[model samples]
Target: MNDRRIPGPLRRRPAAASLAAVALVALAATACSGKAEEEGGGGGGADGVATDIGVSDSTITLGALTDMTGPYATLGASVTQAQQLWADQTNDAGGICGRDVELVVRDHGYDAEQAVSAYSETSSQVLAYSQFIGSAYVNTVRERIDGQDQVLVLPQAWSADLLGSEYIQMVGSTYDLETINAIDFLAEEFGLGEGDTLGHVYFEGAYGENALAGSRHAAEELGLSVAEQRIAPTDEDMTAQVRALAGDGVDAIVVSAGPRQAASVAGVAAAAGLEVPIIGNNSAFAPQLLDTGAGPALLANYYVASPALPIGAEEGTPAELSAAYAEAYPDDQLDNGVAAGYSAISLLGQALEAACEAEDLTREGVAQAMLAMTEADNGFGIAHDFSDPAAPSSTESYILRPDADTPGGLTVLGDPFTSPLTDSYTRE
Candidate 1:
């Protein structure tokens, strides 16, 4: 892992060290607002009331628990910037329901313990968590979030455990559903036939397991064979795994890991003369990989299944939004994380707006509003419907292939694709 932190304006304060000062400042500001709004009292509708800790007549604070100094630091930095952009835009538009959206960001370094500590310190001071960056961190805090009635927007959609959670909402299709869609694309686009063998390289956690589950199901339905390899998030080399899969004569590889791991797999496979196609889940692909030795390898054989369009697709909501973001922050590189951050805030904004309109701005109110959302315009050429708790938030994914000319080193291959497995997959 890189020891250097994210540079420039993107770096954020460590969660544990900065929580006290941030809370004190927020409280002081709130105190002044309370004095002014005392006469007006709560600001909600006739039937709904705003008695939440983070809610005030003029402001609503949101917490962001992110990994600014860990394996995902680059992504975290992009997400934070996108989130700030969303808040700034909303505030410029007169804010959400007349209350300015104030996002308090914290760096948890992708550690579960750090995340818990950050949550403990900041949970009471915010209306809801605008972003929680890791599946493990979320799992660690799941019980507490439920027990305390906290509402949050999860950064990843790979965990089946998050299904139907009252406090946690996701913005994309689950890892399982995404893998199924990827399989469908491969089968159709590449002329994969019965008895074709597919290799899967994945992290050894919920995200990977869920993706594997989806691949397994799809393989069964499609009459394909699966060869599986489990890698840890911290694993640096995937040479052995790739070699074994290649030795097994797998026709293609499906990766459910991160950028580094993805790069390793592609590089090693190329080095070992395995030229089969490699497909990855959303998180497995990153623009940074293009700068590595694996760049050519990836361009030659890599594809990614994304819940949203690529960052700089020529046409779509994502393209327009990315253009606006570039105009706003020219220094930042447009990537999937930035789009993801924007999507999260967009969804949260919808819920907040709905809650405000209903005169219920409490955490529960926000959750209810989110669940009631029938159609969420992702502003990125994707559609998400959260009305059905049993269904994945998104059941479709766009396939992307590497492109040197694109900002994210990728371009959408075709229209968003869906599979029947997604509709029938049971959420656990």
Candidate 2:
């Protein structure tokens, strides 16, 4: 649920209509907001480091800016709720290292200009900056804020681009790992091994191109072949693309597209009797993406490359997050982004807890706490030991064939593609 009471200093804006609304990747942060928190009493540093959560003289303010009310409103709301829940819980627990957690959220409506404005407005006002940002937006902000030493937990994933940057360190698996993980699942489980042609469909832009690049690298490493095609974001009908791919010798299908586009592809594929199993990125789970509301037609014969824990899975600490959010938000029907957002929070919360106890809660203290961690028991064990952001992925992806065997989708296979934690891109 969106906190209605935004600080008056932050401004809101109506955004221009846009496309490329998709799912994203995660964390890397630093800062001590609440000038008071910066100058507050320090807690005991058992290991010579201050925790991400520490006691401030008055309050520990956490600054955030998100695309909460625009094209990507669904995911934005979830991230907003989950983040606030983290603050609420931390506050309830007597605060991080003793300071009461204060969360401040700003809406950017998916606009770069507005995002930077919000960033500038909320800058230095909190202990750290954590928010959901898209690829282009991140690209826009990265260069501008490159010189700041404050930690900014990225709530979205962008593969190796942000992970490798000296200025940013992410907390989740990259799209490169995500795509390969999906392919690995298809190959091993169904026996679509070497010599198999993995058919793919993607949006005709950077999002798709990057995902395709990952697939190419993974396919080569696995000795698999691929046949690719492109779809314009403006096209609502994918019958032509489906017929074309099925007509070719394409085997399995992977979709690197958003909600509306991917749904069209799935619909067309099913209509044409294109039984080749369909695969998609996490973007497929967006609000208008999956035709979950269209009943079985929208639900059957497809799988998604998940970036976070599945919705149907067990409810651990992450599930009981900010009560206000869980009680106020209405995304249970579209919980993919919600789960991903919460999982991202879970990772950050743990890191923050560790950081708060450190001798220094500065940028270096937080980064060291994050990198030093190898065994993070975050709820479902989906991202265990994801300590190195430079490596991009600490865990792989699982298959959610919800439309395949079960009505609500079943995990027919688990961790199909465990990505490498090393620093090299594979070439066939």
Candidate 2 per-residue C-alpha lDDT over 113-188 given as tens digits, one digit per residue, 9 for 90 to 100? 6665566555555456566466555654453345553444554644445554433545555666668767766765
How does model 1 score by TM-score? 0.86
**Candidate models: Cα lDDT each:** 0.76, 0.58
Per-residue CA lDDT of candidate 1, range 63-91, in tens?
A: 89998898678788888888898899899
RMSD per candidate (Å) reads 9.5, 10.1
* Candidate 1 segments whose C-alpha is farther than 4 A from its true place: 1-49, 423-428
Q: Give Cα distance to truth, residue 162, candidate 2, Å.
A: 1.0
What TM-score goes with each of the models?
Answer: 0.86, 0.76
Q: Name the Cα RMSD for model 2.
A: 10.1
Off by over 4 Å in 2: 1-56, 204-206, 221-225, 231-240, 286-294, 315-334, 403-412, 415-428
